[model samples]
Target chain A: MLATMLYGPGDIRCEEVSEAKILHPTDAIIKLSASCICGSDLWPYRGANEVTAPMAMGHEYCGIVVEVGSAVKTVKPGQFVVGSFCLSDNTCPHCRFGFQSSCEQREFMTGAQAPYARVPLADGSLVATAELPSDDLIPSLLAVSDVLGTGWYAADAAGVTEGSTAVVVGDGAVGLMGVLAAKQMGAARIIAMSRHKSRQDLALEFGATDIVSERGEAGIARVKELTNGVGAESVLECVGMEESMSQAINCARPGGKIGFVGVPHGVTFDGQQLFFQQKSLLGGPAPVRRYLPYLMDLVLDREINPGKVFDLELPLADVAEGYRAMDERRAIKTLLRF
Target chain B: MLATMLYGPGDIRCEEVSEAKILHPTDAIIKLSASCICGSDLWPYRGANEVTAPMAMGHEYCGIVVEVGSAVKTVKPGQFVVGSFCLSDNTCPHCRFGFQSSCEQREFMTGAQAPYARVPLADGSLVATAELPSDDLIPSLLAVSDVLGTGWYAADAAGVTEGSTAVVVGDGAVGLMGVLAAKQMGAARIIAMSRHKSRQDLALEFGATDIVSERGEAGIARVKELTNGVGAESVLECVGMEESMSQAINCARPGGKIGFVGVPHGVTFDGQQLFFQQKSLLGGPAPVRRYLPYLMDLVLDREINPGKVFDLELPLADVAEGYRAMDERRAIKTLLRF
Candidate 1:
């Protein structure tokens, strides 16, 4: 099997590797219909996150189950399924509370860029479709596994509601998806902060009512100007850098909500400053398992075209090019076929 | 007129000062029925906050309006009224959204520890009673102006609801008021983290179902034990110090809300740590004005006895002693009368 691995900074490789195998009774093997490079993958590839060793790459995936452990109940072999980037024993208290990402037995998915991936806690993590989906919907189904689910969670956490205004801080794939989610949630205004024309066009296609090309203070000022000088009611902080976080916080009115999805690196917040801002904040890994079923149905029904986010596609052997394209900003997202 | 002033750390004085006069057209002069020392006063008195000048010390009051500027419309001279510690133009977008403390023209009431004080933005700041009640309810009505209102805002921001579990992270006057607020909001279990026997008793009387005397990790562990290893859904962080804020965050479930009202001094949060903890945070000066009317009605109706929080009483000339008693923890709260 050929799998993706990160050797070091800017060193993504595709080479022959041992096949993924179930190591626990709750695990299952899935031959991925498709896989993609996540915005998060750039963390180690760009050297933001230390590459301590050759790390197994990829967390977003969806495909047909080729094998399942005896203990797996809900999902079985030959069934099509989509799972969250976070693996959880979905029966835990946190899982029951709709925060599967914080489940007691949680583990993050890895080596998912390969053709076959081993999924742990299969019964609780994987949502099986009733029947095999058409080949055309695989890209969208793969997105529901993580990217789309995360964007939807951002909107839900931000408390976006009918006739409300929303501001998206990043123009990445997740930010574009957030615009779509906010639109689906009935937000009257969706503002995407993007400096690039291609991403801006995609944002508009995904229902962004306005685009602010400025960054930092200027970006916030533009958002406030568009929102009647009151700022937005809901803000989705899709980028986790210090400047982006500050911009997202400032773009919301008092009592407004900020739902941050990007993982923070060196960001720190002053308690007094945040208190004076008087904004509500809720952020963490998205509990994609909680939304997996509904989101997959949306894809199966062809109600949404999240697949459009993938502007670049490559074969599994050329995985290095996929990472390079996204890292260099030449691709919004890259879909890989086996 | 006798007033309280903080000259420096450990130096509180009761001195004869010039009487308060209207400085703005929206101002009103009120003869305080009662004035009390607050937990926040200790911040400057203890030098946590820099006190560069002789600071007028008190923010809680209920009194009879002695005079009103020509522009004051809602409140008139000779009426009994209570105003929030935060003066806000209630028509602003933030105030209209129930975050009056962040109103466009927000101001903090000052010189409130005097026999007579000038309240700015009177029409929007003061909530007047239809008629004056017996003197027996004066203390409770005064509590509504700030303490009780603040506590209610903490509970409201933490999303307390019927049958929900709540954990209070402070045992000060405001924290005790939070217990009362949680009770009124129908929390099935109210846990108060307090080591003092007297404060714990007061918390129980105010409707705390449990009391954890431990401070840090042990206190969080105690709360977890009580909740069957699952933390409370709502946590009220009434103390703003680093230790208390961390305890409040640790005492909540992943999806729980932490509403912090204590004025944060040197608190800073690492974005990565807070993200992994997955707790929702919303903190600020309590929008006391938003809850003032409802809290005042409760006091007037005698449905709640928030005045019980004031354990010591003294005359205006003994204002220094009042501050000393509260500073030394000799009294839960001290009420000064003219």
Candidate 2:
């Protein structure tokens, strides 16, 4: 089986890898239908996050179960499914509380950008769709494995609700999906922070009522201008850099909420700012398993087109081109066909 | 009039200062009926937070309206009242959203530990009880001015509810007040983190169902053990130190909430831990004015005796001793009578 591997910074290869096999009684082998390059992947690619060794890459996928261990009951062979980046034993107390990503027995899924992937704790991590999704729906369903669910978690953590004014502080695929989540959560106004025309257009299509192209202080000013100088009621911080996080905090009104989904890098929260500013902050991994079933329904019902984030699609063999497209900003997200 | 002045580290004095006067149309002169030393006041006294020159100390007070500016409408001469540390204009959007402490025209109240205090934005900052209270009620009413309101804000921010298990970090007056707030909010179990016998007793008296004498990791373990290894749903971080904050985070369930009210000192939020930990953090200067009216009624009805936290009482001339007692841990809280 061919899989994506990151040998070092700026080095991605699609090489033949051994086929995945069920390694535990609760594990299953999945043949991926689709996978994608993640915004977080850019970290290792840019050499900002260390890649100590040639590690198998990718943590997002929607697939068909090829084989399952005896203990895997919820999903079986030939079933189409979506699973979270974090494999979870759904029966854990944390999982029962809707925080599957932090489940007591958790394993991280990797090497998903491949012909086949092994998933542990399959019953909890994988959600089986009621019916086989159409080809068009596969990309959107694949998003539920990570980005879309992550964005949805950002909106949920931000407390988006009826008549809310939400500010999304990134223009990446997750940010666009955050706009979708805010819209679905009934926000009256969705503001997407983006400078690029392509991402802005997609943001508008995803329900962003406004776009602020400015980056730092100016970006904060634009949000304040749109929000009557009070800032948005809920802010979804999709970029985890210090500047973006600061902008997200500044763009929320006092007593407002900030839902941060980006994997933070060199970000240290200033206690004084948070205290004097009076903003509530909540976020973490998307706990995608918790929202997979619901998001799958939305994809199947055509209520949301998360797949729109995938502006570039390529065969698994051309995976490096997909990474380049995303890295060079030519694509919001790149989908890889298995 | 005499006011408490912080000259430098370990240098506190009660000296003659200019009498309080209404400098703004919205100002009112308050003849302090009762004032107390706060945990935050110790910051400058210990020289941790920079205290430049001589500055008037104290921001918590319950008093009588000695006089009011021409524009003062809600409060009048001779009314018994209590004001929050932060004066606010009630009409601002932030105030309308229940964050009076962050009101657009917010003013910090100082010199409350004096014969009188000039309260700006009096209408919004001060809450007048129905009638003059007896001497016994003064201390309790004074608690409403800060500690009690702050504690209530902590519980409110933590999302404490009936049957919820709440862990309160710190055993100071404010944290004990937090225990009281959690109890009043109907928490089925209230855990107070403390090592001192006096503070622990006071905590129990104020509604602490359990006391964890340990600190740091051991404390977190105790909380986990008590919560069936799941941790509490609501964690009130009343101490702003890194250790206490970290413990508060660790003692909460994966998706639990934390309400922090302590004036933060030397604290920087590690973004990675917060992201992976999945905790909601909300706090700052407590919007005491927003909770004053309700908290006052509870105090008046004898449902909660928040004033019991004042373990030491002294004449205003002995203000230096008051600070000394708190600094030396001889008293949990010291009430200074003008």
Candidate 3:
């Protein structure tokens, strides 16, 4: 099987790798139909994260179950399924509380950007639809496995509601999908902060009521002006950086909530300022498994078409091109078809 | 009227000052029955926070209404009342949403250390019992105005619940009250991080299951060891320093919540670490106005005896002695009688 491997920073290659099989009683072997490059992947690619060794890449994927272990009762061969970035034993206390990402028996289920991948805790981690999804829905379902689910978590964390005025910081695929999530959650006003023209346009199409081209202080001012000087009721921080986190805090009204989905790089809390302001920060690695089922339904129902984030596509053998496109900012997200 | 004022760091004086009166249409003048020194006052006394001018001090008090402006409807002359440190117009959107401290039309109502103080937005700011409280309840009602309310906010923000374990990071009046709050909120276990014998005793009486005398990493380790190596489910940070804040974060479970009511001095957020940990942070100045009503009811019923926090007492003319007691660590909190 051909799989993507990270040898070092900015060094991605598609090479022959051992095929995956059911290694555990709860495992399921998936023949991936679609997978994509993630915004988080760029972290290591840009040398922001240290990659010590050649590691199996990719975590976002949707596929058909090729094989299933005897203990995997819910998932079976020939079924179309979507799985979370992280695997979880659904029966754990944390998983029962809807924090599957922090499941006690959690496992990092990767190697999705390959022809086949092994999924652990299959019964609790994989969700299957009634029928095989059409080719057009594949990419959207693929997104549900990670990005779309994460976007939903961001909106939920931000407390986006029917009449909430929300600000989304970042213009990556997850940020763009956050606009859609907020819209779906009934937010009346969705402001997407983006300087990239392509991402900004997508944000508008995804139900962003307004777009702020500025960053930092100026962007916060524009958000306040858009919100009639009260700032947004909820802010979804999709970019995890000091500047972006500060901007999110500045753009929220006192007592408002900031839902951060971005993997934070360097951020600090000013206890006094936060105390006086009354703002709340909530979010971390999203529990994608918690939203996979519902997001798959949304994809199937055509309620949201997050697949549009895939501006470039390639065969599994050309996975390196997908990474290159995203790295060069030539693609919002790159889809790889098996 | 005699009042306490801060001339500079470690320079507190109790002397005759201008009498307070109804300054706004919605204001009411209250002749204080009791006032208390707060833990936060130590910030300036210790020279941690710069004190600029000789400003009237004290933010916690309970009193009898002496006079009311034409617009004061809910509170009338001769009524006994307890109000928050922040004066807020209840009619504003922020106030309506329960964030009264950030109300659009707000006034900083201070000078509670004096015999008389002005209460802003009296109609919405003051909560009264059926009858004027007996002397026994005066101290308890005084607690309702600030420390008790703040403690409740910290517990609420931390998401303390039945069977949940909590870690309290301060040993002041508010921190002791936080133990009470967590216990009332059904926290099964509470670890009070304190080195003070008096506070530790008070925490035990308030339902703390354990006490940790260590600070920072060692304290966090103690909390984790006590919680089966998973850390507490909720962390109440009542101290505003960076070290205390970091300790709170380190003492919580991966998916736990940190409710910090401390006035943050300097704190930084490491995005990558926070994102990976899945912890949530919430809190600020505290919506004391939001909690005053319920807390007042508890005080009326004698369900909580928060007044025990005051270990020293003085007349308004000798309010400076009360400050000295607290500044010298001779008292957990000090009360002033009119």
Q: Estimate each model's TM-score.
A: 0.99, 0.98, 0.92
Candidate 3 lDDT, tens digit per residue, B1-338? 67888888888888888889777788889889888888888788778888777878888878889999998778888888899887787777788778887888776667888888888788878886779888998999999888999899899989999999999999988899999999999999999999999889999999999999998788888887897777777999998788998899989887788999888777766666777777788877777889998899988899999888888888877766777788777899988887
Write down the worst ten-residue block by lDDT for model 1 chain B. B315-324
Q: Positional deviation of A22 in candidate 2, in angstroms? A: 0.9
lDDT of 1 by residue, B136-174 (tens): 999999998888888998898899999999999999999
For all predictions in the order shown, the interface RMSD in Å is 0.7, 0.8, 2.1
Tens digits of per-residue lDDT, candidate 2, A1-338, equal 89999998889999988889878899899889988899989999989899898989899988899999998888889999999998899898899889998899988889898979998888989999877889989899999999999999999999999999999999999999999999999999999999999999999999999999998999999889998999988999999999999999999999999999998999998776789989999989988988988899999999888998999989999999988888898888998986
Residue A190, candidate 2: C-alpha displacement in angstroms: 0.8
Considering TM-score, where higher is better, how would the candidates rank from best to worst?
A: 1, 2, 3
Better of 2 and 3 by lDDT: 2
lDDT string for model 2 (B51-84, tens) is: 8789899999888999999898999999999889
Give candidate 3's root-mean-square deviation (CA, Å): 2.8
Per-residue lDDT for A110-174 in model 1, tens only?
99999999999999899989999999999999999888998998998899999999999898999
Q: By TM-score, how accurate is candidate 2? A: 0.98
**Which candidate leads the pack in lDDT?**
1
Query: Residue B149 CA error for candidate 1 (Å)?
Result: 1.2
Local distance difference test, per candidate? 0.92, 0.91, 0.87
The RMSD of every model to the true structure, in order and in angstroms, is: 0.9, 1.3, 2.8
